[model samples]
Target: MTRRIVEILKKGQPEETITIQGWVRTKREQKGFAFIEVNDGSSMSGLQAILNADLPDYETILKNLNTGASVEVEGILAPSPGKGQRIELQASSVKVYGDADPNTYPLQKKRHSFEFLRTIAHLRSRTNTLGAVMRVRNACATAIHKFFQDKGFIWVHTPIITANDCEGAGELFTVTNLDLNNTPKKEDKSAIDFEQDFFGRRAYLTVSGQLQAEVMAMAFQNVYTFGPTFRAENSNTSRHLAEFWMVEPEMAFCDIVGDRDLAEEFLKYIFKYVLETCPEDMEFFNKRIDNSVLATADNIINNEFERISYTEAIDLLVKSNKKFEFPVEWGLDLQSEHERYLAEELFKKPVIVTDYPVGIKAFYMRLNDDNKTVAAMDVLAPKIGEIIGGSQREERLDVLETRMKDLDIPPEELWWYLDLRRYGTVPHAGFGLGFERVVQFMTGMANIRDVIPFPRAPLSAEF
Candidate 1:
């Protein structure tokens, strides 16, 4: 028996016999006939099977056919007048693989909560909604790789476990040893020692691939890294996650403006790629997930992204009537509310907020001539506050050293980074895009948990 997709079978091919193996979605038995709905993980719509009482194992199949039962169904594909259905299968045989006790199978033929679905994550992928999401996610991931490869950018893999916090944010998951028995540096003064920590000398998960990407950029001129980054922040919001994937690209001989331009182009390319490649998925999301998805993609592709200074963004926010939880100010870091106000209300379009105050921005950001602000930019979308944050790194050795000193950063940890400037650094710039943030923006998903396969936030990492 040949396996066939229900969608393919529904193309009006006459008298076509096919084999479909899937979990039974629903089954209804009558005196003369039995109808069953089955999906083989190929499409949302499943092939309905019509079984007559005269078929072999008529009583046994009917007795076992129930929702959630896994079985191989062999039948002849035919047209159906079943209201919404376009196709059905006339079954001659049923092969049971897994029998589901109706009472034990938690999932049914109805919608379920994301939280509830998350609890049954092991089985959630079987659901139409989640299955579609996973498919879209896989496509997007592939698109990212293809997008970079086509553009002649080298893909670099930065280490996940690192000795330094790239962002200086102090958020890291410390990797440890399994054997608590044989610890290195068994004992130190006061009988307390940390030299035994897995990697030894306080190593932890990487916060960003930016710094390493910078190293690769210097060597290759243009390089990118797409990988997992860990943060230990405890905030519970729709956006924050403990472990998230980031797409970071560093370019040599590029300034802050170049960094901002790259961000805009990269995003536009992703939007175009996904929209063209994942039309069905996007259509489903536009209808079921967010009604504005198509429009959002249209707007992104059709319009030019606006650019403004951080100070200008603050000014716009201050004039607005939006009551922000965090007060808007020029010198302070823009909260998500402030960012949203700028992107959502002020600009009413995708915009780049740049030139943040040196004190508020990262230490590696290049200092402007004013000696007050850093040459940094954050691309903010209407719904998502800050989707991409990047900066033209301080390439001047003296200036970078002074900034590091101002931040009270340990000189030893960044010796190699500083060496880049000392040796041959030529005004490099780069940005980090939270991959999940992009998916959330694309799918209109509200929670970071739903976009990622196995979300490892502050507390949840069970699976």
Candidate 2:
């Protein structure tokens, strides 16, 4: 049986026969023997295999064992005489499945820029940085499921295609089956007749799953949605993606206080879990990628996140005596720079800012007693600004109806949502977290595109 490199590295005894199937990362030929490093994508470090001249078909096998080639090697584990690695594989036999030409392969034995890696995303995962990123990303995802499941939170599968504009941002990607070349038009030939298209009405790729999560929470009491969300915004920044994954968890009979507690606990749990699960990868990131990687993780795991009201945050920003490109005011939304300053510079830890202005938040956020601000909260982290955004939902029927009307949102389109409050309303709250943003934070990667396997962004969807 073929053994994983990670398991062998951890528990394989010396002189034990083993078989490893993976792609060749590098090869160094000598007068009497050859050395090749093979990675199975199970860990950051690859297994170094030594092949002697007396091995069967040595020249033929050597010809095919270039970088990026796939092969299966039967070897005996032995203590390594070289530095860095603890053990090395003494190969008795080798079988090559495919050959990669060293001259044409995009990934050489040297460092490549993230921009060039983005272009070759198909093969970037084989590199050290991307591979480490992917490992950390997987650890994060597993931690998410484990954390939610441990608390009796049901994994709710929300729809990717939704009709309602959850954020009211108007950055939706319309989903229509109507022929663009010869679309069905209205009687006056003004707008495309969406009624004649699929779904019998206009629909869009969901920008968020918060509303749908609320519906499930009403039934399940506690539920979470982890799925893909899309936005048609033309943002070309490192922080924005046209298509990304979001984690939204809604809980019935919960208020803003409970929401804040859960968000803080959730973040701490994920950080601890990832560090425990992927120490080697985390160490690699700390030593090579960003020197502060381990320190940031330690800070999050050990410290208590600071909590402040949005009003107080605004006041602090105003009194800081620091110049900001965007003006800090009470009613205006906080910019990334402002968030970073509060979390990275001032607090030096994760900061939870709550009770945002109603005009700046979504219509579903519970209107505060003052009627000016909503019970919304944002969890801002160092380096990355807003990692999680959530709010206590408006459960009062009259208030929800009035807020929807004030925002000019069509009541008919969200009839089901209004029905939740009209029939059996309960105080509930939830938050939406960008999965990619969290991965980027954990790895200290400069670009959001580098964290995810295949990133979909403006004018770039090759893979």
Which candidate achieves the best lDDT against the true structure?
2
Query: How many pairs collide in each candidate, listed in order?
Result: 0, 0
User: How would you encode candidate 2's per-residue C-alpha lDDT over 211-298 as one tens digit per residue?
Assistant: 8899999999999999999989999888889999999999999999999999999999999999999999999989888999899989
Candidate lDDT values, in order: 0.83, 0.93
TM-score of each candidate structure, all chains considered together: 0.92, 0.98
Q: Which ten residues in a row have the lowest lDDT in candidate 2?
A: 161-170
TM-score of 1: 0.92
Q: What is the lDDT of candidate 2?
A: 0.93
> Evaluated with TM-score, which candidate comes out highest?
2
lDDT of 1 by residue, 55-156 (tens): 887888777888888888877878886776777788888888878887888988788889998888788877877776776677678878887788889999
lDDT for model 1 comes to 0.83
- lDDT at 358 for candidate 1? 90
Clashing pairs in 2: none
